[model samples]
Target: MTKPLIEITNINKSYQNGDQELRVLKDISLTIDEGEFVAIMGPSGSGKSTLMNIIGLLDKPTSGNYDLEGQEVDSLGDQELAKVRNQQIGFVFQQFFLLAKLNALQNVELPLIYAGVSPSKRRELSKQYLEKVELVERMHHLPSELSGGQKQRVAIARALVNSPAIILADEPTGALDTKTGAQIMDLLTDLNREGKTIIMVTHEPEIAAYATRQIVLRDGVITEDTRKGGEI
Candidate 1:
């Protein structure tokens, strides 16, 4: 049998808060298969962001096991973890974290530059992904020159440029208006249909509805896990 793309078990995260321990995630365990579109939903302080960080390899759990593509990741060193993160996970943020100075194409090309791709190949891949996000025409535009949705599209293109195993989107629609948010969600839905594994963090029910599976977190614990067909 094929292994899951991501398998996490008994994960917990905590932080030190002025001599007190503040738990952010509580004994969470979940598996995500390739091509699944999952939404992690919660109110503020629900540990959804913490969970996303752990899944994206940006933060370590206080304790737990995480296996990406069947390999244990909890044991990797900082450099190893960075390498894995760079190669395996793509990130999209609510802030659309594009560099203000870089044009859309250059921003998308940044990952390949870090990955040490040839300059020509970086340009080729970046343009391809920008086209994929339907922002090729605006490739030379800076973040400030683009609309909110266009900026997010560039962010999406950057996320796709690495061809990572999973796309981790945190409040992707938070920075846009309703109509533009819907358009972004439609793009995400279309990407999922094309076999990308998307894990999105969202507080909005309308946004979560775009995903095939919804996992609700409350007070650092998973309160509900539901699939479109039924509860899972």
Candidate 2:
């Protein structure tokens, strides 16, 4: 059998708040196979974001075992973790984090820049992804010049430029109108159909419906897990 793309076991996350220990995630275990589009749903403070951060290597679990592409990662050093993140994970968030000073194409090229890619190659690849997202016409426009949907598209292009193994999106549509949000979801669906593994955190049922599998979290625990047809 092929190894799962992500394997997380007995994961826990905690933070010290004044004199008390606040536990956010509790012994959560999950496995995501390659090409699976999974949506994580939860209410406020349910630990969904914490889990996503751990999966994306933006943060570490206090105690757990996490394996990515069959290799253990929980014990990797900061630099190693950064390398893995740059090579294996792409992130999208509700707030488009594009630099206002940079144009769409330049924002997309940022990751490649950190990866030590040549300027010419970075521009070429960034252009390719921007075109793929149908934003070629606006590639030269800055984030301030684009609409909410357009800005998110530019962020998506930036995320895809790295060719990461997984895309982790948190509240991707929170700031857009229904129509624009639908368009973004369609783009994500198309990417997933093209075999990219996506793990999105959303509170909207309609948005979650775009994914093939849904996992609901409440109070730091999974309460429901369903695939298509409501299969658990």
Candidate 3:
């Protein structure tokens, strides 16, 4: 059998708030196979964002195990975690987190720089991903010079430039208008069809509809896990 791309088992997370312990996630178990597009949906405080952070290696679970590409990662040190995050995960956020000083191509090349890719190779790969996202013409434009949709496309291109094992998007369309959001979703769907594993967190049902599978959370627990057009 082909190994799953992501395996998360019995995970939990909590934070201390004054004298209280606030649990953000509880006993979560999930598996994502390669080439699958998964969506996570929930209301505010549902722990959806927390789960996304753990899955993206930005945070560690309070308990249990997580494996990425068959390698255990829950116990890695901070530096190692950073390395893995750089090499294995690409992140897309609602806000286009592009550096204002950098142009689109330069933003895309940032990850490659950390990965120690040569200058020529970085430019080549960044340009290819920009082309893939249909942003080749805006390659030299700064974030402020692009439209909202164009900025998001530039962000997506930056995410793809690393060729990471998975793309973790959090509320990727929250900042766009309906039409622009739909265009971004269509772009994501195309990327998933091309075999990139994706896990997106969104509160919008229309946005979630683009995913092959949907997982809904409530009060730090999974309330539903279902495929598109199917019951849990």
- Root-mean-square deviation of each candidate, in angstroms? 1.0, 1.0, 1.1
Please write out the lDDT profile of model 2 over residues 1-232, one tens digit for every residue.
5459999999999999999999999999999999999999999999999999989988889998999998899668889988888878998999999999999999999999999999999999999999999999999999999999999999999999999999999999999999999999999999999989999999999999999999999989888889998767
- Give all candidates' CA lDDT scores: 0.94, 0.94, 0.93
Best candidate, lDDT = 1
Please report, as a residue range, the 10-residue window in candidate 2 with the lowest summed lDDT. 1-10
Candidate 1, residues 1-232: lDDT per residue as tens digits? Answer: 5359999999999999999999999999999999999999999999999999999998899999999988899779999998888888999999999999999999999889889999999999999999998999999999999999999999999988889999999999999999999999999999999999999999999999999999999999999999999999
Better of 1 and 2 by lDDT: 1
lDDT, candidate 2, residue 111?
94
User: Model 2, which residues run further than 4 Å from truth?
Assistant: none
Q: What is the TM-score of each candidate against the true structure?
A: 0.98, 0.98, 0.97
Q: How close is candidate 3 to the true structure, as a TM-score?
A: 0.97
Give the poorly placed runs of model 3, Cα more than 4 Å off.
none
Deviation (Å) of 146 in candidate 2: 0.5
